[model samples]
Target: MFSLGNVRVRTKLIGGFIIVSLLIGLVGGLGVISLKNVGKKAEGIYSQNLRVVYILTDMQANLERVRGNMAELIYVKDQAQKDELKKSIANDKEENTNYMSEFESINISDEEKKVYEEFQKNITQYRSLRENVIKLVDEGNFEEAEKQYVPIRKVTEPMFISLDKLININVDSAKSANDNIKAINASSNMIMMALSIIGLILAILLGVILSRDINKPLQKIKMFGEKLANYDLNFDFEVTRKDEFGQTGGSLVIAQNNIKELVKTIIENSQSMSAASEELSATVEEISSKAINIDEAVNTIASNMQEASAETEEIGASIEEVDSSVIVLSQKAMEGSNNSNESKVRAKEVKDSSKKAIEESQIIFNEKKNRMLKAIEDEKVVENIKVMAGTIASIAEQTNLLALNAAIEAARAGEQGKGFAVVAEEVRTLAEQSAEAVKNIQETIEEVQKAFKNSIDTGNDILEFINTDVHKQFTEYEKTGNQYYSDADFVSTMSENIAAMSEEITATVGQVSEAMQNMAQNTQKSSEQAEEIRESVNETTQALEHVALTAQNQAELAQKLNEVIQKFNI
Candidate 1:
């Protein structure tokens, strides 16, 4: 069934207002119609009835004036006075005729028209009689004019009666018009009053309907909201209407049911979680014990690995020392080889120089002896010998300069120039010796002639000794240098072999040391891993304990929630 309760509030209010407004409109419209009708009837009465009455009254007044003028015509004897009255009587009759025309022009009913026609006939008779009376008066027949005028009373009497009747018709019609106006006014007042009452009733009914439709459900929803605020879900609110309030109340019902179910589920889950938390606490303890044992074992292995690493480091250090010693011996052998080779080179160079010196000495001796003998035969031997000594001294000076230049070049050669520098120093010494011998020979030139023969004999013995002893000493120096070079070469080769072996041993020791270090690092990492595992187990145990506490709290909260939920009546 369609119900007003299910109707929208706005629609209800609007329908109620429309009904009241329509009633008001009807009331207003009826009043306007009634007033309009009254105005039309009043206008009809004024135009048709009142105006006719006005014209009839004017006609009656004209009759009276005509009657008075007729009497005046009878009494007056002056011709001028009679003429004046006659003119006045004629004007009065003309005015009455015009009034009759106006009366005929107005709208009237058949009965009013009949009565007006009768009045018109009687007034016509009265006017005819009045004219006869006036004609007699004008003829100076006073007696007869008086007699004629007396009969006018008979005509005017009925004429005035018809006039009064006609007037009364209009009066009666006006009265009826007033009565109709009164009736319309009375009916319109009644209808307006009825409509007013109906509108008021409708207004009140609409107020009641709107207020009840909105406020009843609103108050219910408000109460429901208050209960929900207080966490009371036990209040049963059913949606009885399809209005806005009903829909909102339905939503609240759904929310309360959902919350109730959720609280129940949480209670059950809390119980399960509490049991699981206890089991997990025991498992965490067992894990912590095993983690501690593994940590101790890893620490023991790490300690043994550390000892092995230390021993490997010691062996590496010993091999390093041996390698250092081998390096030093190899360096010494290389130095001996270089020095021997230098000596052998110097010996070879000295031997070649000695042979050149012997040749050059013999050529110089023969040439100087021939010059000396020639200078003696010319008694210029002393001067020539002195010149030769000076020449020799100059050569020695130049040789010393060359030796100094050689020494400078040797000095620039660094360590390799030590042998060359020694050789240059010997050359400088020989140059100085040559210079001294030149000085002595120059001082003993006279004795040189005396020793010339002995000098020939000494030269023979010197050449033989130089050719034999000097050549032999040069050869022996070359041999000894070769031997020293061979020995030094042998020593250098042996020392290199020893150094290579030592380096190989050192590299082996280094590899062992590195392996040991890696093993120790692995052991240390294992120990740290064990420590981390133990710490993680301890942390996990702590976390489990926290979780257990939290679970217990959750269970308690769930129990409290169940108790709270019991307060609701959803």
Candidate 2:
């Protein structure tokens, strides 16, 4: 039959009782041995009684030998026979005394010791009386020796009877003691045999009972486990005890019942799950298709953004072109202004040169008139020459002042005006030289007036021709006539400055255009990537929904199994 737990109750109780009883029996046997000192005392007394009996018998034998020698002395008439008998009697008496003393020393019953002492007294009296008879015989009183032997026999016969009586009593007591020892040994042997037999029987019985108790419940558990392994869903088991082993058995039974219910629920849920899984898989496929559509939409938006970025790039390029054109126009305008300034400076120089030519022609005419007058030594021509020299000196000082003003302006222009400053310094030096020339001319005119008065007429005619021709030519000139001519060096410096500024502007424009292009491209790319990320998140949400549904199905299956298990009493 099947027990719910791993072991039975009856077998365990039987084995436990048997173990206790065996332990008690072993203690009892030890107690019997512990209190056995009396038996040893009995055995010791028996041994001493045996030794006493032996000594007494040896003493009796010695006494008999002494009596026989006395009889032999009576029959013999020879002196040698009497002497030999006396010597024999002496040796026997010594041996008998030693034996009696030893027998008295032994520990026997008080009554036995009293009987031994009475026997010893009689033997001593008989020996003393026999010795008197022997003395009479040695004195040749044969009749008197025969009379003494009569009394010795009386003593000897009674003593021998008492010795035999003591021997018989000791033998009887020894026999009784030995029988008691044999009986005790037999009883102890019997007790040991009986206890051993009982212990063996109890051990065998306990073994069978304990084996059954353990094996029964274990067999039940094993069978249930086997069924569980086989996935049997209809089996139920129960345990109804309260020990540790019983509790284990009960727990196992519950576990088995739970497993059976669980298996049934799993089987049922598996059928339902198969259909749901198919629907879920189909739904996931639909979701994946929608994600693909969203991806396509994102791709379209990305393409449009790319086109917009490209349009912006083109617009930026156009703006850059306009900026470059403006830069070129500014450079050309600055160059024209620089050219106009140079032309004005060149025209001023030409005007100054023409005025100087007219002044020099007027001076030649005056010199000729003075020469003509000087032929008659005229003082008016000399005074006119001095006035011309003073006017030339004042003109030279004004030119030098103008040159100093130009030098100051050139100095303000730094390294760019080094050539202008050099030209201004040269003009100043020419003005100083012209002043010296005018002074020399005034001195020469004075010397001429004094020494070449007659040659003055010819000089006057040549002067008149030179003055008329120079004046005619100078009158056709205008101060602004050379205004159109520009200074090539100043124009070149302006062009170089313009070219450097244009290069800087061009580089800055190019950088601005490149930065704008990069910004537009990055913004477009970010918008496209954001749309992609949004699509990915939507897909992830759908996947999480599917997973949540799967987990919900598992939890529902577990609940159903719990309900199914409730049907069993186990």
Candidate 3:
């Protein structure tokens, strides 16, 4: 026989149900058998024995009625009354005969049939005696009629006794049959209850056995799954049964072994990659260092070339400036002779304009100074407002904190503090709103301070510009105007001197231009060499960058491999 443990889970569940069903069927079969026996006994009592008892009672009643009618015939003296009695007696005899026939027709036991035959013989003798008694009465021989009634009367008691005995026998048989039916029914109920209890117990036991058999393997599988989830691959999966759990365990073992081997290979490869990356990193570092050195040397050379180029440009610019000044001086000297009278007239006009301008500038400067002072005062006020806003914000924060403390105290008081908590929450909300308003005010004040500072800085810059550039230019203009007025007579002498200096400046400008040309050619040669070195450095830097990138990629790959390998236990 195959054990339950060896069966598959589906088969085990099915077997459990089948055993429970068999038990139920046994209970049903017993009930059916007992009920069928009760039905047979009930049929015997109701159909045969009880029916015979009812027929016996009817026959006895009819016999008693016939005997009473025959006895009434002897007392009847009137012809009409005697005739009525005789008719009645005849009808009674016919009814008794019919009852006897009915009794004989019924199927009965041999003992009951024998009793019935004796009853029929008694009834027939009584009917014969009753007929003779009626005939004696009809002949007006009342004495003879009375004597005939004696034989009829003698047979009546025996007939009644026989009928009683038959009724008693049938009643006894009915009682025995009813008792058998009751016994059958009682046995059926007891057998059914016992069988039902046994079936229920068997079902429970089978269910427990099947559940244990099923859950034990499942629990082991679940434990194995948990271990696998936790990366613990060291335990043994010892379930080797032929069921699904066994197959699953076998598959898991194979997978675990495979993962172990795979991880080992991955670890080895990751270590190898790590080592190679380190070596490559070192090589890249060396290359990067050398590239940096080359770049520095190239940059130094480029810097020197750039310095030389700048010096050449400055020398050229100086030569151009000198040449332009000489040309201007020569042109001015020629114009001086023609404009000396014009200069004297313009000199007076310039003097008047300079005094007017100085007066206007003084007025403008005073206005600007007063505005700047006001701006400074406003800046101070804005700063004070910013401070006040900060203080208000701090106070709001403190108020919020106090509200929060109050709320906490209220919460600690439980139900009694619910109303207080609501009030505290409202206070906290108001504090938060006040804080927000203060924050907005602070932000506005800060913006105003920044604007004031910017305005102050602009005013200072204006003042500085006026004092440095405008004031100096105006002073020089005024001095020049005064000098021109004073030097009106000496203009021709100055003009002659300026003509002599222009010739000397022209000669110096030619020599400076020639030197500038030589310096430019040398600077061009140096710039070309610097460009070549720079190109070489750039190529080296790119090569080093490529090597570094490759090393970084190798490092990242090694790190990822290590992470993957760490997921399995060896």
Best by lDDT: 3
For candidate 2, the per-residue lDDT at 558 reads: 53
**Cα displacement (Å) at residue 547, model 2:** 16
Off by over 4 Å in 3: 1-3, 83-87, 265-561
Tens-place lDDT digits, model 3, residues 97-194:
67667767777888888887787788778777877887888788989999889888788898998889898888888888888888888888988998
How close is every model to the real structure, measured as TM-score? 0.45, 0.42, 0.48
- lDDT digits (tens) for residues 173-284 of candidate 2: 8787777767766776777777777777777777776667677667777887777665564566666655455677678767766665666666567657756766665676
State, as a TM-score between 0 and 1, how close model 3 is to the true structure: 0.48
Residue-wise C-alpha lDDT for candidate 1, range 1-570, written one tens digit per residue: 988768876687788888888988888899889989999998898888878878888877887887887777788888898888888888887888788777777767888778767777877787777777777776778898888777778877877887898888789989988998998899889889988997898789888878877898899989988998887777889789887667788888998899888867765675575567567656656765665676566566656655665666676576666656655665665565566556556655665665566566567656756665554465455668779889999999999999999999999998999899999999999999999999898778767655665655665666566557765675666566556656655655665566566566657666766766676666666656666666665676567667656756765665676676566554
Number of backbone collisions per candidate = 4, 6, 0
Q: After superposition, how far is residue 3 of candidate 1 from its true place, in Å?
A: 1.9
lDDT of candidate 2?
0.73
* Global local distance difference test of model 3: 0.81
lDDT of each: 0.75, 0.73, 0.81
- Winner of 2 and 3 under lDDT: 3
Number of clashing pairs, model 2?
6
